[model samples]
Target: MEDIRDRILRPGVNCGQLARAHRAAVLIDGESYFAAFRQAAMKARRQMFILGWDIHSKVELLRGDAAVKAETDGAPITLGPLLNHLAQNNPELEIYILIWNYSMLLSLERDPNLRFNLGWTLHPRVHFHLDDEHPIGASQHQKIVVIDGQIGFCGGLDLSHYRWDSSDHEPDDPRRTTPAGDHYGPYHDIMMIVDGEPAAALAELCTERWQRATRKSIDVHGQNQWDAWPETVQPWFKEVDVAVVRTEPSYKSRQEVREVETLYRDSIRSAQRSIFIENQFFTSTVVCEALEERLREEHGPEVVIILPKEVDGWVGNKFMEFRRVNILKRVLKADVHGRLRLRHPWVGEQPKHGVMIHAKLMVVDDIFLRIGSSNLSNRSMGMDTECDLAIEASSPEQEAGVRRLRNELLAMHLGFPTDEVDNLTKETGSVVRVVDLLSDPERPDSKPRGLGPLEAQEEQFPELVSEAEIVDPKRPLEIDRLLDIFIPDETTQHSWLRAKWLWVVLGVLALVGLAGAWHFTALSDYANREVLAETMAGMARGWTIYPLIVLAYLIGGLVMFPVTVLIGATAILLEPLPAMLTAFAGTQVSAIVLYFAGMKLGRERIQSMAGSRLNRISKHLAKHGMLSVTLIRILPVAPYTIVNIVAGASHIRFVHYVFGTLLGMTPGILAVTIFTDRLLAFLRQPDLSNVLIMIAALVFLVVLTRWLKRRFT
Candidate 1:
């Protein structure tokens, strides 16, 4: 049989014909993606707009060998300072960034100690805004950059932190940097560059996103952020029709369209040769289901996936890892000819330190290139907003370029030359043949390698598991059907009987505890006087020190009574003026503990626990780190005790949680301490005005608690 590639490239069925309608170029990995994006940005004559789920301005567009001297300034280049210069130099350049409105509660309300509002201080020429009101919790997750309607980028690479690095991938290279602090690993991502008609289509997509986010039309003609166009950065492919696919559940209600998900399904079904993919996540049941169908066919095309061993964050591992594992199982079952393979790149023997794959891309034969920010998951398909650029090459030269790019990626993975991989493809007939030769399980070379020294170091660490498992796709549960498992069944009489028995047991315990307290207090006059005073004061003033202590105990129960409770107890017992200081200490300790817990739990388990009330709490911990956690704990709206428990369960880190907690709780602690001191003075002296102020404070606390419960729940 003729090889799949040859069949696709054969006369009349030429792969070039599919993409000839537009101009296109292949970005093999992160290095190429950034180079292409920077080149396009520099050459823009009309406009520059970036749309993403999350856009971190600190990301370097060009690094390592691609770092070039600035035309206007002689200083070494960085994206933040350089963009500022570009905007000043070209007044016509309008740079707009639309990112997902990560919940305000998580981003701002939870982190009280942060001094800078990152969204506000990006750049003078750059405009940033959180995209909310797009239907409940839906997000804007398209990673696209358009310049002058001439060049466009669409793929998984986002303008985010820790994404910057050189293709040299030297593990010990002192040049690696991260916005989130040290200890973070490097990353690998991919994107597609296109021009001509395809570029125009991407521009339109950006305009549409801007209109949706801001509810106002934007004119791209006068807003181009770059000076004269650089001819070198122009699109590589010429004259091809590229279709724009988008997903936004909020907008779907207004317009009956499901383009993004449909595109994925149709594209997978249409593949007749080879399907190559690189994604940050691989947990989409629908996509997996489609692949399973293809795998069952004896003549199905080969499937290849490059992914990180796990996602970056702790919550990501808990929530997404399991689903990905399950999805891979399904893929493996269909690999009858051993035509499917999944590989993750690691920098060192320890999986934690190496660069992880973060790119989302799919190349089908040499004809179609699909790039986008959307992960292969249900949430990205329609639940969350997403956008993609699909470019096809119609000419043989373009097809050859695409083919060469694919081989280059394979070469990098296999430690073989791009030319050698291309020759092998021509000689052997299928990608599987080349992959098998380079990826023998018994051979050390078959194991994935990192960029350089990172791989060497990782080799010294414990090896990761590589055995494949099988999953049955037919057992998937529909969303509505799955809800039945949580709902109660018909057993009204039995439930009522159980409730009565539980109430009786609770009442007996309460009576016994009350009697024991009375007996213990009777033994000491001071203890009895303090107990009576606490009861009377709580009833009369609605504020009592005993209740506060009890509240601390409740918090301890919720957060598994972590170190926060002990610290808070110590502070309360020792400190006079700073009574609330203990609460702050406790909350901070709990937050740190939770962060470490989340990181240790990993991604697969997290996804399984998503959608619950506790899951939302976990997400808040992951999204904001310690800052947000401490803020919420200090803010008096949510119970400090509950927050601590949720924090530990969510898996936030210890250092960030502790720091953020200490900083965020300062304001609240001071306020509460002053209020408590004033109340204590009123109790001792019996001042009417002081009593009134205390009453007001009590009322505020009650009202705040009600509001917080309603909002967060």
Candidate 2:
């Protein structure tokens, strides 16, 4: 029989040099992890390295008694202030922070002032850098904290708001508020604490990311800095091998690394009796396919997946939730032995929301335990950046530690003591049986805590959700590939050709309708007898006529007069402020009409018109929707209405769409409206000021257009 090491730990599957771990503890959630990190950070004598996707400046590091004491001693408790305090007080200590250059749309959730980035930069010893070097849609998603190269933390919890929660997960904890005093729900995540050579190895990983991002290096650990390990936190495992793995997308020059995916698949495949998992997302097709294969085995492991009942944001709703259901269907079909159990942890009886299980954790048959930031999503598999660490137990002591950690996690979810879980497992000789016992009717409060099974159902509007796959792709995307998905290459007629034909027919009808109005209406007869310019000039002077003309422009878009024509006409006919207001209002109103029409039409019909581009846009929007929409609006990459229609049809949040449109259209609208008004004045009176106004408008338009294009492209 192959050993667990031989089955799981290969060179590429679990990348990086396997370092000997002198001691390791599995910190269950951000509350415990943050507390431990605080103690370690306080004791650090030399250096500290912190890396994350989102690191808020105002996150409270020391909670409970530690926080109370720190406050008593006149020490700052929040992350940014605390780091600054540490750096200032300990002159010899060097601190480095690397955070992902996340979307500006998330400004409300993160540090809007960017004090974490700028405030830390002002400090001499505390160096901070924003990692924006990855692929367009990829994120630097690893969360690692190394203190003085002696103690290391790697896992899902970022030092940010809405992540600090204890394992008890009280349904209505008043203490679960952000620095801004915004209350959040209960959360769950895990971080692995390591000391000795393994800690040094992770410290090296942090430095590598920092150096890649900043193009500069600092000596973090000159000699072994093992003296800084906190005495308070107990180690679960001693003298075990640690495997550091990562998922890096190929960008510019860096080669893609998918060690996390490979390790997960191999671990699932090698499970002898039972497999347990906890993650923020369960949407990786590759990972799901692997589980399916394992489930098909006659004597395969019983898999238990603990996940969040609902994804967090609109993008998450757009991409992950539906994909999860589809993936869940595939897994359920393969579970012939009735072995797979998918659940979400709940707090009280019929809780309002399930505890958000953000822990990227896995365990197999008490032989292997893996933890890190790699979620079971396509992004984590190969697209976005990730890091995962694992240990394959080789001795009795290591096995005991792995088993203990697994039970601890399961116990927390089941709302039972670890000893109860241990006894139940021993009595039944099966982890699956233990789960059955905790959830049985005979047990007191047998409602299984918050660990409830997720029921499979037919997802509503599967195509709308499926379109998100383009944005939340499993692999790197090329421009050509994205275009192909959105706009088909084949000229050959297909079923969708009928939809295209209808659009062409509609265009012809629209032109005919416009012509009929001009030829048959009273305006056409009036135009034949009077000069058009003089009539428009007289009409512009009428107080009610100008508003009526603006109304006509807004309504004209429904029948298809090019928006540019309406904009130019509005600019030429009216004075600057009225013209600007008219154009902006008309354009926005027209966009809203198309947007609503698209949303009403549904995704399948829209796909027939635009093909996979819908998916590509969805994928990009998932990660950076607000920015993408803003850029598209500013640049006029496609027709203005078409952009709105696509966004609405694809179910991009209404708020995001409106915000992008409002901000993006400002410069162009002001430039064109002002330019046309000044040009008309120059023609009538030929004043020097009017000429200067036109020149300034031209410069603004050119500069704004070029800047926006460069920013995105």
Candidate 3:
């Protein structure tokens, strides 16, 4: 019988191209990949290329082993220090690191791009660039490491945090912690390490990316002819050929390649026995449609998919899983023969924050294996950059090797040995049946270790988040789509006024707020107005009063205490200029406080406090950045504190939000302070001193407004 892999593994059809790997191995999870990378780098003498969606230098490669730290008199085996040591020690070496110039929406989770050396400022040989050379919304989503063009590592594991776990995936593993000491849940991923032709190919591929990202070309033509593979790493396959494939989105001069998408469909059609998959996300409609095509077959191969139970303890946002459920509903509808099984890994008697499966892998017919950074999602199809490595067994021995790997992965999930899983599958006549027999979440037994059926459950999703394409787009974002999300067709130009008109409206509203507060507080009860004004002015001049005024704004904003009331009170109490300064300082401080609170609480927890309106601000922040924060603040679309909390939970940069708040709040704060102060003075006595003070304040505000408009617009 002809090998099914041979018919489908054609160049330019199923994949973009192919490259041979002399030796290949799969490193499971962060700990394995990190240690392997550290070992390989120690032998690197020429150059190293590090490319990722994110890069952090603070990640500790080795946790408990104080060998490297002890040798260095206490410096840990962190990414930055390791790279620095290699670069500084080797004169022939040049290191290039490229990371995505990401959206601020992920600002809280990711460390700031610390410019090449992480934050430590490593040797000058290290070159780092924050690559924003893609389409506006698309990211540079490839995570690859090539050392000296001799060995390469590629897959879903980035040199970032929230990725470290053993195969056991203990629920309370003490070692599962970030550099900042915050404990995170178990994370699972795969990294494919290859040496020889594949390594050189990866080096060449990412060098092109480097040139595209940094515009500095270096020669990667010559092979180093040295083996850089780690001695301790277990080799998955040897003396076998491997195919390298990719999904590179078209933008500018670059042409789009949907090879990964095509390869998936081709491989699915070629499968005869079973198709097994493990992935971080499962929202790809095209892949699901292909699965549907196969599922409709009366005696088609049984399908098994493994996914994370939820998105909270993992990398994705909540809405992606909500969309995953929507996709699952479609795929399950096509399963007429009960041949498809969706499973999630669990640790305890019941699932409590299930292990985060970050691996992107698939095996078909126990003869072909595919592993890479590409997820089964719309974005991973052709919108984002992706890379994958595949192998087709050309011999019976190699085919059995592939079968053994699939069984081993199953055994790891099922908490059994590879032989047991292999034997059980043969006995049950199907892999899905074996999984169903042992993989039970509803089992009454005290210990529940293994896979459980993946099901769609009711999720708490905010409005507009159900717009799936908005979150996981198949193409680069469109301005029309963003506009459609931000504005409705019914209310056109009139409701949202021009800049000048908006200022006039806000100014009038501020004056009304001052008058209402004065009346509501019964300020007329004071017998002598001059004496009352003098007493208030004296209180404002005291040093201790400033902190008190700021504290009131902080407390008032969080507890839904009306901000206008606090502003009006400040205006009534202090002199015009002093009152304006006080109001601005108070509001900025309160926003900063709420923003940090939102940072610690995260998005879902913030939703519990602020609700659906946060999505409105988040959507804006994603598209508009600083301008969105400014506009929302000026218009007061949601509560003052809610916007700040959402901004903290969103992509808006901290500096941008701070300055935007200042710009947006300046007009209103100035208006309330000046007008309320003048009104009180006028009511007391219509004197030239009060009149001159009001005129001077008005001039200063006009000048400030004109300057701001010219600078920003």
Candidate 4:
């Protein structure tokens, strides 16, 4: 073993911490990774840390031979149950889990916290926290697990649903199903396991993340000897120094970091023989240009990349493909020597679908092996929080191990033996040449179980290409960008410096920023439509919801809340018809309360509260009467409550105010309620027809928004 103090990883450069590990191994696919995790977890004595973008309670962590032991030993096989079982058995063992507070869009795919926290079977020693401390539009995407500071696992494999799969990735693998018995397609991923100094270093990193997320320090109990490494897995490298790289967006006082991105560019420039990559996405232009630069060289290394045929969702696939195609165009144009190959793994014959390659791995000339949660996407490079492990060969044995690892990965993808890949690589000087020798055919489909050329699908909707930057941003959503989206720069210029409409600018931008950020409240934890319906139905039966609903509207109005959001919430909690009527009543009541409050507070107090623009708008409302109030309601001119107060201060007649409120508020309330109901339906059971209908509705809204903007201006 090497000295732990002889660290090669430099902080703020290529890694947060670099240390030597006695043994390090790569576990291909979820079956191997999950099984190994279960084995290592079963050996935990003091503490464990689990962190990831998604951590479902129902993930099946063990199967095959591991499942057999679960039945005999009376230990649960599912991740949540297994951990709880272990915790109950060993009172000294404290398991801490920190998972991203995922968006509402992913609620159905993830289990509610009730399954992990409220269940009677759950053990007290198990601590769980939904991490929401990240910058807007960025997720805590690191997948890392540390067991008692001895053994550590870090990679793209999350302990979540639809992750478990054999290396074969057969198209119709029956084992690929959710806990509720719904089927999924072939999936692929990788996990790296390490012990010795690297394990302890990773433990330190995990605890730091925990402290940031939970505001509490994790007490580390030390042990020099670690025998918890999984017995089934074989070490790929021995006596290796590995660097732990990280990527994080700057937020508040925390500085930004992009070590993974920096290393990718550096490794690409240093490649002597080849660049072999397997990733879910390849859309970062920065990385594409780095490859493009290398490809332009007269005798540069060949570059080979493997990507999935499709992603999970229709919208995500379309957007990612749009971005990927654009990058593919740039790289192919630079490949003057034709030393580039892009491929997708297939079954015995090309089928309707193929394995989803979720591994984030790169081998540059077999001299550097990089693997972890970072996909070759813009978000993974900057916006999203990411972690990766890299080892630059400092010895001949280490260099050979890197070559062997890349060869093994290529062999599995091509459905050939590892030794065959090794031999072919030696026979041919180039990986691109090796793939050609193996895959070239007189006719298409001649080779059943080998690499298939993958190119960008034709752009049926070229308009989606423009949305690549918005959908896969490389940095946090800034307030200035969001403000520009809502209010034009010219509109904010004169007002910002004077701090005249600064409050208004911030208020308006807050609404847009919140949407773009997808930042959720605690209510988002129980955001499933079915869950909301059930919970509210029980509350409704108690005769308690009606008053609380009115109270919420009043409080929300006073705080300048977005009334449409409240309306949408009401729609989710009740039948569509009831929701519309309730929203109308709540808004009308809230309006009257604010209107009277404005009268009592007078013009001076109103100006102090609603800003200087209130008086200007009030005069317009007072003169136009019902028509002005109606127009304001239809447009996003001001907050709902702010308008009510200003209208009260105006000399507008009370009768006209009542009629305008009814006319203006009805359409918005109806639209929000109907849309909320329909959106829930689509989310519950998505189909082509539902998607088409939603598109039509979106187009209609765009036209309406333009008309409203013109009229209001």
RMSD of each: 18.3, 16.9, 15.0, 14.5
lDDT of 1 by residue, 258-333 (tens): 5666666766777787888877777677788878887778888888777776555533432345566666777887
Q: lDDT values of the candidates?
A: 0.55, 0.73, 0.74, 0.75
**343, model 1: CA deviation in Å?**
1.9
lDDT of 2 by residue, 221-314 (tens): 7336246666678888888889888998876545789898888888887888889998988888889988998899898789988888887664
For residue 306, what is the lDDT in candidate 1? 78
Clashing pairs in 2: 345-450, 346-450, 471-619, 485-612, 485-613, 486-612, 486-613
Write the candidate numbers in order of decreasing lDDT: 4, 3, 2, 1
Which stretches of model 3 miss by more than 4 angstroms?
1-5, 65-76, 112-117, 221-223, 313-315, 350-353, 440-448, 465-467, 479-713
The worst-scoring run of ten residues by lDDT in candidate 4 lies at 497-506
Q: Which model is ahead, 2 or 3, in terms of lDDT?
A: 3
Select the stronger candidate by lDDT from 1 and 2.
2
What's each prediction's TM-score?
Answer: 0.59, 0.68, 0.66, 0.68
Worst 10 residues of 3 by lDDT: 498-507
Higher-scoring candidate on TM-score, 1 or 2: 2
Residue pairs clashing in model 3 are 104-651, 105-651
> Residue pairs in steric clash, candidate 4?
none
Indicate the worst ten consecutive residues by lDDT in candidate 2.
498-507
Model 1 has an lDDT value of 0.55
